[model samples]
Target: MKHLKKKKKLLTNDTFVIVPFYNEGKVLINVIKKLKNSFKNIICVDDGSNNKNQIGKHKLGVFLIKHPINLGQGAALQTGINYAIKKKAKTIVTFDADGQHSAKDAIEMIKLLKKNDLDLVQGSRFYKKQNNNIPFIRKLILRVATIIANFFDNTQFTDTHNGLRVFNLNFAKKINIKNNRMSHPHDINKLVSKYNFKFSEYPTNIKYTHYSLSKGQKNLNAINILFDILISQLIKK
Candidate 1:
């Protein structure tokens, strides 16, 4: 089993974990607690969550940003990234607020980023399946999407839409993310290839709970994603 090497030096003070949230009140608190010790800063962007009342007044020493309107996940993520940059973060790790990802795994991704000097380190679920309960339909969509992304963008990532990723501050700053919708992952992949940034993939475990599966993007969203990619390409052309 491959594991991310632990960095000899502690994570830089400029490293931050960015989590985009939307009505994930039940899980967010625990996620925050789990990750608080690993990174210097934790930025949680609440994307106009309807269940904000449920979140309560909990200050875990991490910065929380709120949006008045329900923006898409992509917008929330971008908001967090911008906040991290403003805070002078040198590295940003994009994490999920739904409790699907483990904080330890996030730390590993950071270590991998430092070890390989990679612009981005993406977590790949396809590398191993140890009690991972990924839905069949979602798995198939990801497989097809990964193939299309690799072929069209000349990239070889096993998991194209994994939210767990670490980005170097310099390369991340160059990314002009215009997609304010669910297709942002596709846009990011395209940008990585276009900029000729060094990217690597590492295995990470994703626990697919029923709540997460139901709340996740449906198969129909793939059409919108494809359309977004095409529109982006045409605009570039």
Candidate 2:
């Protein structure tokens, strides 16, 4: 029997961070500053924030792209991905601007991605659950959604909705992210399984603030996502 060869590890200089923003002006600034100290390149996509005062004069060393109107997180992410490709980024890390994800965790994810030779790395908040503040109802919904997503994709993933993830440039370019709305995270996982990309997961802390909790998607959105998925499957059939 022939043995499969192990893949090579990723390099530090090849990694870049992408942050999608809407009205997270000050929070976005803080995220960029923290990420700058760790990652070599950082890209910020302004998804048309109406705050004119917060638009100009950002201090962090980041490549900023702005949309005239709010284009949603998916569009902002796509913009950042395009910029990353143009800049010749070998690996791109997607980060949240809501101050939920930590810079230290990002560094660890990058290192793990390199060591494991994975095409994508996802952060799983439920792995340890250091914070007990996560609502029980939300947890149940996420669990059900994760089960459905795994069944459809034929892959096991602990956390399906976490925004903190890293992807290789090639794999990132191959994804057809049509949904410019809240369903992009699920799309990413489905694509990874569909494309047969190598992926891994790492535990990370998700700090929940009052603002973030308020801004988070409602429970009804999960039902909407399920409906969308069902419609998509039907259309394909």
Candidate 3:
């Protein structure tokens, strides 16, 4: 009875949801509210946003960590991860603040992690039943990016850049993100390959709204990210 109660408690608590945001306005609050329904601990890492007032109002049951300067998503995620570790979070979930990711997916991923006794569960938009709303150009870019990441990282991943992920503390302690920007996804993949963590992909839903699309990465930026990864690889070589 005690073990069952503890297991149920672990599912409801002992999980921290890390949300890294730049300039997301009220969308972030809504995301937090939705996540609160399933998760008790929520960490919001503000990566030096100009509009700080938007998230400043919500503090109940949420940890808001502010970066003095814009360090990028990787840095923000690292900050949140470190905080969660200090809090002794049994499981850590990385979620996007643009309102594109689904909180239900996150909950499901966490449950999958505990149930399967896996180290990590990555969300994939193209894994099973694909989301048709993905912009054709964006989908092409992601497909190309996944191929490149797989070839270099020597691992098969359906979606290389999906933000929704859940991992246990063992994997969390092994993570050290060097790249602080867009190239961080590649860095994470490299780490996963290097450490050989027990992981799997879960089909997730991506809600693409006009606002999210506007905030999405541009074609030129994608090119720059590729260039950045190429240079980083060269430097390592």
Candidate 4:
């Protein structure tokens, strides 16, 4: 008699996707729907949006968490991460609430993370030669930021501000993003450097629509993020 072998379980089943948003209008719903097609555990953290109706009604299998007042993206993401950790998620993904990130790319990143036994896998719009349709000023800002981050952290990364990332419970438990605002990326980079986390960059697709661009960070805000990080570092010293 021949015995049958059991098939491997789907990666999406044990993974949790965290989406942090503030006043995201109708695009948030569409983003959640797209993620739902691939991810079973979805956590949407609304950072005190005045219009609670913006996300509309929550769908089945999706968890919604709200803040009393508007915190920042970092705070919202931390909230979602805490919830997912409490639920015993095997993996966690941080995704932008704007309609720019692709669910397909996230799935691929998760696969790479598991296959290589990596702690974190970050999505890079400029990882390889591809058409991300990035605006000129935004591209310049990211390039400069990447250079500065690499100089200080001694790490190599093509894009510093991309919000798409996948990681396992080890990273989720070890990282604590305190910057609470646009500077959280800097905080993440600092943690990665300090802990020497095993990480890789994956080429991901970014669809920059007018709506997404409008919702993105302003060009000048990059300066403020730098200032915030510098001040935080000074305070630490």
Candidate 5:
């Protein structure tokens, strides 16, 4: 009981940074360390990682949760959300584990959420202006996705697939991520309308590293996501 209490006290954080990772051992610990500077409560959901031992070894004030198998990124994120809610977290931020996202963007997003008393804040790579370093193919994917997403929701966001988002506890309760894969982006964007969350997208400087670029979705994956959406719609019938 004493040990559990100590762990809880040490792990308790007002700002919970929830990260869903799958075979990202190379960058997971580093990502947590970077967030440690800005956030106190950190939760890393291991999505059936082969390196479960590896993640367990890193005790940097992170509450590590493990999935028995590779469910999906969306599942991992949802698991983290559940844990964060149970812990009574005041704020929750979803961060990418591949390190494509910037900690500065997360800090600014959370700050804006608190200052403006907004329920949700999303990141946009193309908001304001985009960097030339963005690959042409990657840029095209985001643009097309953004266009399709715009048709689904009234939210005027320049980037639709961005993973960096901050949610207040109240707003987080309203968010129920059902997608078990990358389709989570669409699932979340569509929910804003249903809940009427006071949401807005802010400019975030995204850094596409070689590793992230290599691990990123392909054009073929886009077709699969479209198919998935269509199937989901059909299922609703």
Candidate 6:
């Protein structure tokens, strides 16, 4: 608690937030609203949504960037990060547009990043929190996925797929999220391991509302995510 105060004093200023959404209209707005209270600079990237309605239209003090065609979440994040870098942002945050993520947790993640002078801070919902609300099948999939990630990537994180993260410009500039969709998280881990970036995985909480759960990755989709990662690496080779 005391440490958070010290970190927040420095991090709350000039912090850039990147929110990527695809057709998450109203939920995106509310989530951004909550974030505005925590940071001054916020950017929302519309990831080529098919919906006719626009997002953050009347929301003041928020930067809105949109892609013409549907790109993956990774591309949307890259777009926002590029803009933040151009604007001379020292630190940037990647947040999910869905209501699953909490602004309070984001504050802590950013603070820890600055407090430890780390390159990246990742939020892990499974760190210490009970997965009571998590569906049984979902819980099994995530735990297995975490084990696989740690085994192969050599990362010791408890949660691998949480969308909340903080990165200093040095690391942010080095990021290239080519996987685009759900596979982006895996690609980011590869980059982190490859670059040997200073990072931490902190315990965080998530709200598994029906809406958020519905938008979440299906259990069967893990197979597809694995295939995509393999194919991308194969292409690089």
lDDT of 2 by residue, 99-146 (tens): 889988887787787778889999887766555367888888888888
Model 1 ranges off by over 4 Å: 1-12, 53-56, 128-131
Q: Give TM-scores for every candidate, taking all chains together and pairing residue i with residue i.
A: 0.89, 0.87, 0.92, 0.92, 0.90, 0.90
As for lDDT, the candidate ahead, 3 or 6, is: 3
Better of 1 and 2 by TM-score: 1
Sort by lDDT, best first.
Answer: 3, 4, 6, 1, 5, 2
**Which lDDT value does model 5 have at 184?**
78
RMSD (CA, angstroms), candidate 2: 6.1
Please tell me which model should have the higher lDDT, number 3 or number 5. Answer: 3
Q: Between prediction 4 and prediction 5, which has the larger TM-score?
A: 4
Ranking by TM-score: 3, 4, 6, 5, 1, 2
lDDT top scorer: 3
- Comparing 2 and 5 by lDDT, which wins? 5
Per-candidate alpha-carbon RMSD to the true structure:
3.4, 6.1, 2.8, 3.5, 5.4, 2.6
For model 5, give the 10-residue run with minimal summed lDDT: 3-12
Clashes of 2: 0
- Per-residue lDDT tens digits for candidate 6, residues 103-167, read 88888887788889999898887876755477888888888887876656677788888889888
| lDDT pick, better of 1 and 2 | 1
Model 3: per-residue lDDT, tens digit, 64-160? 8999999999899999999999999889999999899997788778879989999989899899868659989889898898898888888899998
Q: Residue 31 CA error for candidate 4 (Å)?
A: 0.9
What's the lDDT for all of these models?
0.80, 0.77, 0.85, 0.83, 0.79, 0.81
Error of 4 at 189 (Å): 2.1
Candidate 4 local lDDT, residue 201: 95
Candidates 1 and 4 compared by lDDT, better number: 4
